[model samples]
Target: MPAERQTETIDGHEVSLSKPDKVMYPDAGYTKADVVGYYRRIAPIILPHLRDRPVTRIRYPNGTGTRPFYEKNAPAGTPDWVRLATLSTPGSSKGRDTADFPVVEDTATLVWLANLAALELHTTQWMIGDDGETRRPDRLVADLDPGEHTGIEDCVEVALLLRERLASDGLTAYAKSSGKKGLHICCPISGEQSDGDVSAYAKALAKELEVERPELVTANMLKKERDGKIFIDWSQNNAAKTTVAPYSLRGLGVPTVSAPMTWDEVEAVRELRFTPDEVFERVDEGGDLWEPMLERGPKVPEVEAPKRRKRAARPRS
Candidate 1:
């Protein structure tokens, strides 16, 4: 029998969905149709974050329980209606110089991706300019990843400290769940600073936090160093890197979304993970919590590197 196929007109664009009944999330029993529907409903709010950014998708063609692969370039057979961006990715492990990445500018493109089982949509800190070139970073992110024996509560503690630290520099911070096991603190910038400048500021801030609370936070990227603390991953601000886009679904055991949070919720830190249905309800009740990051804001302030206390050398016997 021929594979079942269906077409839907979204935003005046017709998109085809294959295997709409195929289960993408085995644990949650969510099908390809469910994924496409979620993206269609979420497009109104998520488009801003994805509009001009080149998306990197993590595809699970065999369902979330099976192997997954990262797709940076627009896959073969991509619809011509889908917007494309030719980006220069220097030092890419794949050894490619330039890649044609997909830019999700509308609901149809998003639905297309969902049909491919692209559960996770990741984006860089920079945006594509009107000339189709990558621009300076307009936002900064600090990913609070928990280590062994640490959890969301630990990330919340670090996030609050980061909020205060960023406030001291005159920048407002927003909080969100990583949709997996971490928390993301983001702030909008004026789009005037280079990726290096923004990354330096983020690194400096993370280092400062590490110094302020050595036992609770670690700026070091080494997993061993994060045994009992939240690792402040400021490297995600690099131009070449991509963080999971807010409202994107994760390919975890269950269907969880990268949901934005209010400071009060962050403070409470009880329920950080949210399912797709719950996220839709959240949008109905609270609107977009990540909307504040869409506005133009101040530049990232230059931060002085905090001096680390030197470790005492052990005398050889």
Candidate 2:
């Protein structure tokens, strides 16, 4: 018989977990308790990245293979210790009804979310600031998505190109496999820019890359035009937009993680992937290589936008 609930001590905080023995990864036979435990083990390192960021919980109540839905506003009956951030639309605090979002403060709250089957943690690049109402983004993400016929290798190629381009602009970025079929390259900033500004900047950079390497990259988001190229998804840097947090487990059949990687590791991804236990090991040995993501802001100098090029007219059939 399966257990109905569990009460575990995590970081000295007692977390009440329901459906502890419920199968959350059906094929792997891993239970909800197992995922909670994983989060508990990784809480120390992963917690910092999640600190202050409003999280969007992607829950799979039954199992990873079953139905899942996104929950941005934390559900009812949330504990007091688990902090919540409220932000109104257009990034204001005074003009409208506010929505309360959960902020992960410690391992106990993390365990609670995990127990709720919040397997994928999606957070904004920005945090609500100390003054209590600022939505300025501190990170920029360039999501390299491959087309139907393309693969991770293509994304890797484009990512390397982007890495070089960002370097020339005096900023450094960290790369991580999306734990599925994509790659997310991120740059930590000084938290001084609006979400709109960062979004526009990402779009401009993607457009610049598209113009330079038309055959390999495309800013066009439509599926038909991206059959064999990499699509630079820049829309994720917006105020309400959220990307998967590093160390979050993806519901991709196996317990795959959105693990961080070095440039060389990305180049040789075909050789191996960081598995669930493997990621824990990586943290145990190297600490968070992604720590640099919170280190400094971009040193980008202002540059004039590139002029649009006129494409040659197509001949009539």
Candidate 3:
């Protein structure tokens, strides 16, 4: 039997969890309490990836597989103790010039999000600096997604190509499942490069891969050309774009996690899907595989900016 509601002190803050036994993952029978427990246990590892990042949460209030909402602004009634980052979104469609997004700094905050059924936590490549503004992107990502008639195996092959290409450029690539039908190859980068520079570098690499293996890979985003190919989505490195934070859960009617993997695991992976229990077991055997991504490294290789074509002179009137 589970309590209908209860209060627990986490990191010096009291959080009230209600309907602990309510199933959040109806397929897996995972309840709200279970979600809270997972975040509590995974906090130490997950927080590093989340710290200083403004999270955009995908909330499934009624439970996974149900109608969900994407929450960018900090929800009303957020605890005063939780840190908020106010970002200026000029020309915004939401009709607000600024958004108060929550930054998870401690276990209590994570638990609070879990209580809200925020299963998917997405974040940008950059972190908020001490000055309370977004810093230069410190990470670059190549999101390799398999298209129709393709699957994990195709993604793995493309990832291997990426690993080799990155190594040749003196970059170390880290692998992680997208918790869906894709893989994300991340590299720690020196924060010296501008966000646009980093994104350009990623775009260059993706184009290079596409050239080398045209059959297995495609850098284009067109759906018609994606079938039977791996789409290397370099745009995820853009300053405004968000990728699923490592260790966050996916609401695919199951309790799958976006888990990090070693190069060895990536090389030999038959299936990229990993449930919460499997992730815990892997963590126990091998510490946080994503820890290395926090370190500063060399800047991404410079890319040649695309040359602008000259406009034709207007005909003499």
Candidate 4:
């Protein structure tokens, strides 16, 4: 028989946790409660990134050994206190309507999602306003994907080069591992640039990187064209797109975390791939290294601003 369910009060809100004893990570024997505990510990740094953003959770009911499915809309039994954002995007593959995705603004909501075995917390780059309208991205991500037989080491070197290149161009870029094979170098896109503008700019930047290091980097998304090179994927900047949230636990062996890191840490691959325990301890020591990504409005150099509307509409709040 399954373990008994329990109700816990978090942030003055009641959240019912079911089957807390179910092992979500078999290798490490980490139960559903362990996942909740991890999220609770990392909520401070993670929740800020998720505030007002619609989340698409990757659920693994039978642990990492089994197949996982993407869930966009919050389940019907979501707590009344947990907020929801009705977005107009491509719904899930299962044909479920995701016009409403659960928003993780507080610890209670974060822990609630974790208990559902939502191992990968993928969130949109944009933020929602009071009227629930999602806007442009605050930062642009260059997902450095390495091709065939290559590893994180290649991505690390490319990330360092990209960092310097962006700095010389007058933009600040931050690096973090994808908790898998690649490194994601995020550049802060400030001012008021539309999603299309940011996406085009990122594509241009990727093309320039490809031009500079044809032997080591390729902007081609095709697998056939990219062999032993890092491809800078610029598509993650789309308004309808989402990427794995930093500090969220990935559904990998032993629960690897999509933790944030500095440029120096990127130089060291071992430090980049942080496990659950290491991530918790790292937070206990260094605080949140990626907090700069959330505190927007730093005037990114040469940002492409959208044109003034012809309709004389109200300005962005």
Alpha-carbon RMSD to native, per candidate: 4.7, 5.6, 1.3, 6.9
How far does residue 154 in candidate 1 sit from its true spot (Å)?
1.5
Off by over 4 Å in 4: 1-3, 90-98, 297-317
lDDT rank order? 1, 3, 2, 4
When sorted by TM-score, best at the front, the candidate numbers are 3, 1, 2, 4
Model 1: residues >4 Å from true position, as ranges? Answer: 1-3, 304-317
lDDT of candidate 2 over 1-317, digit per residue (tens): 86687687766767788988888887788888789889989998889999898888899988888889888776888877778887664553334466788999799999999988999999888886886578888888988888878877788889999999888877788998788888999998878777777777788889999999888899888989898899999999888788999999988666788899988888877732466798998888889989998775863444455689999999999
lDDT of model 2 at residue 284?
84
Instruction: Show the lowest summed lDDT stretch of 10 residues, model 3.
Output: 126-135
- Cα lDDT of candidate 1 equals 0.91
TM for every model, in the order presented, reads 0.93, 0.90, 0.97, 0.90
Question: What is the C-alpha local distance difference test score of candidate 3?
Answer: 0.90
Model 3 C-alpha lDDT per residue in residues 1-317, reported as the tens digit of each score: 76788999989999989998888998889988899989999999999999889999999998986899888899889999999999976676798988998999899999999999999999989888777565589988999989999977789989999989998999999999998888999999998888999989988988888898898999998999899999999998877789999999999888899999988998888888899999999999998999999988789888999999999999998
Candidate 2 C-alpha RMSD relative to the actual structure? 5.6
Collision count for each candidate, in order: 0, 0, 0, 0
TM-score of 1: 0.93
